[model samples]
Target: MTTESSDARPLPTLTRRSGDDLRCSIARTLQVLGDRWTILIVREGFRGHTRFSDFRRVLGIPTDILTSRLSSLVEAGVLERRGYREPGARERFDYHLTAAGDALLPVLGALAEWGNEYRPSGHGPSRLYQHAETGEATSIAFVTAAGAVVPLTDIAIVPGPGENDPGVGPTHPLAAHH
Candidate 1:
């Protein structure tokens, strides 16, 4: 005998909460990616960094912090240590981004665009990107499938009524009084 679709299995339960204070999805996502170095490593990894020294040289990250960040990223599945080698100059190994890590480029693009607008000038960017053809700033934007620019207001925050809903929750600072 065959069981019905919904009857075949029950929804898996949450065996543990993330932490005492952080309970939301955004919080959980941030818990993994929120490290200051994670996104930078991701950005550099996208630019084709596959070794420890390469990340070190590009980011100028402190050795201790960089070590922690790399380990965290590997555990988070954002990177994978593909092989072990001792080039006679080293005793350990190098790391590479998995396909999962390569998929974070859009997030980095969004962040870069936001920073370009909000971050103050004179606070030099460690590096910059330019168009190969014209050699001008590489401005990032979001476009739809048919190639139309998507505006920020077009984005919506949809949270069902259960866990959290800001619309009906405590008023935000920007919220208008009713």
Candidate 2:
């Protein structure tokens, strides 16, 4: 099913105030990327589009809103801005997703897959990815080399003393990150 703009994933709703510990890695990551348009911008960047006008045209996003989102993404190091110029035209800005942003593609793909499965749809997915080698419709799943599907599992932490706990390292990979 093709998700419409109105399809029911609501905007992220986390808030932090001064002196609050938004220190968890997941929370910190969300703080930078939790904005509605950030991932979409990364998506487009991966598609080889760089210029402001290209993004504006493809996304149909408002210019100011796009500007703000782009700015935020750049500030967060998810994107890099570079200048380009055309003959007889003004210098223009372009954006490209950084490695950190590209790393989120799998996460986005997973979310898209979930929405397709659970959401009601008279038709099946609007589009399907095909396996190039076999020419069969394909989707991504977490599986072992032996083809065993893996279920999500809780990750346990072994902490040492330092910052996270008394003897923990200065930064816990699981804590306060983006």
Candidate 3:
């Protein structure tokens, strides 16, 4: 199920199951932000939580668990640490989302959409993303290269030049529905 890549150098002969873990982008993304608490912490970041106490209080998360998740987020380049102190206080670190972390907005939006759509708990949207200028609620969607928004059935799975196995992605457990 290999495809030909037109690159001068060969890409890694890898899959999601690769030992070095450089294969599937999704797998690597999960490795960085795989856990529930980790994702929640990232969500809190998007919600403007920077201080450790803010996350702990808002999420009702323990100090040690919040600390570990913040460390992991920083290590994964999803968040950056900044030192802050009051005039008479000792310095402490605050976590802010890096560019990589900012890129996760859509992922979180998609997850929120899914929860709102399928797992409704009789509540409305927890929060809404609004256009800063227009104040219109924003939503995530699949857009084509032609700039057309299309439905899932319109999308297709094909081998990319670097794809090691066409069978792997299309039939993957997560993507199987789509």
Candidate 4:
């Protein structure tokens, strides 16, 4: 029996997420946080980049794209704009991360770990996450219902309190495919 060549690229699986009935938190989240630009903006905000000019200078992003992303973040309650004046300058907006935005640290950590492990950029990691008190490097993991951190092998996904049939039910065709 012959196997497919290792160099072969697999065909892309086409699927459309059910946005109309997006009762899933992850779906609703992706809509607001949007894309890599939005996520990177949030990361920079966490890194203490509050001003628009600094975001543009560091990210090298176009003003229009930065403007749109900042607006969307504020609208989503993930960021709050505060009036600030630098020395002799007139008042300008500084984007501050909200409580909801602060809660995404775990998600960011998980994504960073996955990227470093799988889809590397050849350049070694540019930054590291450390525990504030212990000063040790930190990593993310899946925890159990009992609050015990466990390996992916030890975990199981079952129905939870938030589980519901929101029109696009659990049996939705795309659900199994994913």
For TM-score, the strongest prediction is 3
RMSDs, each prediction? 8.1, 10.5, 6.4, 12.3
Model 1, 58-92: lDDT tens digits are 99999898888888777766788766667675456
- The TM-score obtained by model 3 is 0.80
- Score each candidate by Cα lDDT: 0.66, 0.67, 0.77, 0.75
The predicted structure with the larger lDDT, 2 or 3, is 3
**TM-score of model 1 relative to the true fold?**
0.62
Candidate 3, poorest ten consecutive residues by summed lDDT: 1-10
- Inter-residue clash pairs, candidate 2: 1-125, 23-176, 160-167, 160-168, 161-166, 161-167, 161-168, 162-166, 162-167, 162-168
**Total colliding residue pairs, candidate 1:** 0
Tens digits of per-residue lDDT for model 4, 70-178? 9888877788899988799888999998877787788788889999999899998877889999999988986656879976555545544455744432333334445
Candidate 3 residue lDDT tens string, 1-178? 1122232122222235674356555767777787889999999999999999899999998889889889878877788999999899999989999877787898998999899999987978888778989999888887877889977666666555556764656433334575
Clashes (N, CA, C under 3 Å) per candidate? 0, 10, 0, 0
| Model 3 misplaced stretches (Cα beyond 4 Å) | 1-17, 166-178
What pairs collide in candidate 3?
none
lDDT at 90, model 2: 88
A best-first ranking of the candidates according to their TM-score comes to 3, 4, 2, 1
